[model samples]
Target: MRFSILASGSRANCVLVNSGGTYLLVDCGLSQNQIVDHLAELEVKAHDIAGVLISHEHSDHWGCVESFAKIYGLKVYLTFGSAKARDIQIDNVSIIEITPQNKIKIDDIEIFPITVPHDAKQPVQFILSDTKVSLGFLTDTGRITPFILEMYDSLDGLLLEFNYDDQMLQHGKYPNKLKKRISDGYGHLSNRESIEFLRRVNVRELKVLVVGHISDNNNTLSKVTELLCEIGGEFQKIIVQKGKKTGWLCL
Candidate 1:
């Protein structure tokens, strides 16, 4: 299996995953034109994508889902709450309502959606596998749950959220309310929280760790790098920047 983070951040977020030629997009936050350009950079066509799996209804995550799915005639897999929250209205696009109960199969890949603790209604993160290799795509979540720890126990690759630095957020220019919202359990994860998660999970079989959803204003790459250095793991680390794509990594 191979995947690329087309874009990741507060502004927009998307990911492209390919398992034996069956392509799937985790989210469609970018404009259609931008997604096309990024796909071209990886030599992938938009039409080749089989489906789009939406995490939640947040604009940064669900903004372009309808348009993109309509344009490509692709299926959109999301929770009922997300669909209700967005009030999706595209007639031609296939809307598959998913829950954390069962796994969905799309050609070569099997996707398992697990509920996450975000402010949005019925938000979820994904665990994808092609039988041989498995990947966990998690972001936009505030805190990791026991269910998450159970599902993500053995991953070949992980695209995780390293959204902020705790100290920086506490002292940043943002207002008190926004700061409280961000630091609260329903907001994004901090560098310290992410590190703690890494420590708790089993990384013995983890090969690639792609850190994403970094806050441009509240965190710096150097800080993320320094934190990563302290972990001292054998997994290959790729720190993603806002609006930038991490070239495809295979596992």
Candidate 2:
């Protein structure tokens, strides 16, 4: 199986996971043209995608949901509330009302829609697997919910979030309200928090841990790399994903 993070940040979030030529997209936050262009850069075509499974109704996540589905005739799986909020009822869409702990399957993938604590209504991160490997995606979450921690205890690969650095976000030039929102446990995770979570997980068997959704105004690639290095050679053995780039890894 193969996985890639097409883009990640406050601007947008999208991930591509393919196994045995069966492709799935985690989100459609970028524009249709942008998504297509990025895929082309990766030598992938639009029609190659089997479906799009959304994490929430946030525009940063579903910005191009309707357009991508309409243009490609691809199937979309989203929560009922998110569908209502976005007013997205596409003919090719598979609107699944997912529960906190429900496990469902689509085509050749097994999906576990693990609930996450975010401001959105019933937001979830995906754990996709076939017969050999399991790829877990977690981002845009408030904090490290125990459910997520337990579920991702032993993943083959993870697309995790390390949104901001405490010093940078606090000392940077931003409004007080925006600062509060970011620092809130309900917003994004700092680099420290992300590292802490990585330490708890079983990183021995994990092939890769791609850090996603970083704040450009508040964080840097060097800082993220250094933190992972501090965790010792286990995570350093894998490649890291960037905020606005494509990172592909095989498991």
Candidate 3:
């Protein structure tokens, strides 16, 4: 399987996973033009995309999904609550409502959607497999759970959320209420929280660790690197890379 983070940040978030000629997009936050450009870079045609899976109703995750799927003639899979909350009904697009923990198959790829704690209606992340290798993707989550650890424990690759730095968020010019919301359990995960989650998970078979959904205003690459290094031996074991700017990764 080949995985690529077309973009991951507060501005927009999208991921592409390809397996056995089946291409799936986890989100369509980017504009149609931007998504097309990124797909071009990957040598994938927009019409060739098998499906678009949404994580939540947030604009940075599914804002352009309706238009993108309509234009490309692609199916979109998202929770029913997300679709209703976001008013995601559009002509010429196939909207398939999926439930959390339900497994769906698109061609040769198997998709497992797991529930997540986010300030959205029925948010979820994906675990994909082509029978040969498995890849787990989690982002925009606030707090980590034991169920998350169990689901992502032994994946070949992981795209996990590392949204903010605690210090920066606390000291930055943002309002106190906003800061609290971000640090709250239903907000975003801090760098420390991400590292703690990683340490608690079984990383024996985890090869690639790609940090995603980074907050440009409240986090820095240096801080994320420093926090990861603090994990001691576990930090040096996996091939870690930050998403968005790192382009594509294959395993």
Best by lDDT: 1
Residue 130, candidate 3: how far off, in angstroms? 1.3
- Can you write out model 1's per-residue Cα lDDT over 137-207, one digit (the tens) per residue? 88888888888888888799999999999999999999999998888989988999999999999999999
- Report RMSD for candidate 1: 1.4
Q: Please give the range of 10 consecutive residues that has the lowest summed lDDT in model 1.
A: 84-93
Clashing pairs in 1: none
Which segments of model 2 are wrong by more than 4 Å? 90-94, 235-243
Against the true structure, candidate 2 has what lDDT?
0.80
Tens digit of per-residue lDDT, candidate 2, span 85-109: 7775644335555555778777788
lDDT of 3 by residue, 53-137 (tens): 8988888888688878878789999888898898766333499888899898989899999988888888998999998889988
Error of 1 at 224 (Å): 0.4
* Residue pairs in clash, model 3: none
Q: Between candidates 2 and 3, name the one with more favorable TM-score.
A: 3
Error of 2 at 23 (Å): 0.5
Q: How do all the candidates rank in terms of TM-score, highest first?
A: 1, 3, 2
